[model samples]
Target: MLVAVLATALLVGCSPRSEPAPEVDVTGGAGEEPSLEYTPPLTISEATSEVLWEGTGPELEDSGPVLLDYRLQRADDGSLVEETYSTVPKPFTLTPEVLSADLHEALDGRTVGSRLLLLLPATSDTSSFASVMVVDVRPTRAWGEPVEPREGLPAVTLAEDGEPLIETPQGDPPRSLVVQALLRGDGDQVVEGSTVTVQYTGVRWSDGSMYDSSWVQGGPESFDLGSGVLPGLAEGLLEQTVGSQVMLVIPPESGGAVGGEEDTLVLVVDILATSAPAPDALTEEG
Candidate 1:
């Protein structure tokens, strides 16, 4: 039933004449019929400085357009409400063309990075009554650490320098990842600055299916170590202490793949070796 509703909502959302409605519930909870005239308040969760500057920063004498990346949460329970990282105005303009009347009245001339709590009055039958929203507005650079970093997992270990290495197979995969300990390193001959060569394999988390691998091709895939790879890959390889095995759960968005399906990816990599090739070696023969 929930899937049906979500599928319907997605279809409606893509309609040409339709406007995407914020996921505001008019009734507030499951099965409670909504009042005919209840409209929720409009709250700004996050915005780029550019949007705030043109829309609300006119009062500042030397304000340059800034970009805001923020996390919004529900004021009621503090549960994450929504993320507008890629919204049309993800880095939307505060210009006249982009600013809505509700925003103009609520945020015009407001300070950048200021947290604002506001209400949105519903305009129709489907709208909800005034609700609480917490907006943490900040410059675009503020977008950091999309996900909280977890401590080391027993199944996986990082070299002294923090690069992750997977434990060699003792028998079979563990039931789940187990917390281990933090790793510290000597920081010498580290995989930090130079291009480190390694082998890797990818598998589907849901069905344990192997999707792609550089190992199958025989030789380890040689990237400049850190260049041209996913953040997880870059971080994993660079910080990995020499000669360690690592397992990584790659989110779809970071995997350079099209996503919409609900599933995760598992990556197992072995740091076979690390070498800091000479500068001219880039053009030199292997």
Candidate 2:
């Protein structure tokens, strides 16, 4: 369903018409799914978007990953088409190659946590339909209050673009797992079995050499905390909030071997977004 909508939305060249953009009454607080009130059979001369509410977080200045929660409705009848508010928010890169020109313009210069209303006109293509979209911008990196790390751990610093730089400590790695929050976000808490989107860098405690990185992979990656992950990495992410950055020190027994080495693993993870399992899935698991 979303694929079809995106296909039509990304296409260029809408047939020009005389009708003005409809006045949509969007009613919803921040972090809630919006309720849109607009008359049916809406028409617009061109594709346009309006910022309903602005955000206070970091301003987008580059082509990077953006987390979004949005809803699409048929402009002709306001019929429900698809939405991401009830599930996990989707990720998209902020680039002209990845998004339509109109969408890229609407999202550019906007800060995280903004809500936008977009009016797209029908194209000449027979498969196209006019759409009214409401979008909520979620943070793609950790954005929150900073926290002080405890003493005697590997120090962490940030680059100009927010990537973590790790300096290895001199002593032996801790025998047990260590989970420390560096940036405390206010978003949803990660539960026991949630899927999370994150940007992370993993380094070895022995020589401070990087073993893995999501940032080096071009963008963030999603992980299901319940399976197919290092036991200590998954355990450390639990209870962390969205938009937070955390440091996890995993012992050899918990982190297992990394790159065929049995050394301790040090990971700095930026918790971008998290989606808890649905009730039915949890019931099945139980």
**TM-score, structure 2 vs. true:** 0.89
RMSD of each: 20.2, 2.6
Q: Kindly provide the TM-score of model 1 when superposed on the true structure, using C-alpha atoms.
A: 0.31
- Candidate 2 lDDT at 195 equals 84
Candidate 1 residue spans exceeding 4 A from truth: 1-190, 256-263, 277-286
Q: Candidate 1 at residue 126, lDDT?
A: 21
lDDT of each: 0.38, 0.82
Q: Estimate each model's TM-score.
A: 0.31, 0.89
Model 2 vs truth, CA RMSD: 2.6
lDDT of 2 by residue, 1-286 (tens): 5545666674553333356667889998998999989998887557778899999878876588777789888888999888987667777777766666667778889998899888887778523678888999887678879999998899999987788999975697889999999999888899977888888998999999898987776667777886789999999999999979999999989964777779888999999888877787699889
Candidate 1 lDDT, 8-70, residue by residue in tens: 211111112133334432221211111212133333232212221222222311222323333
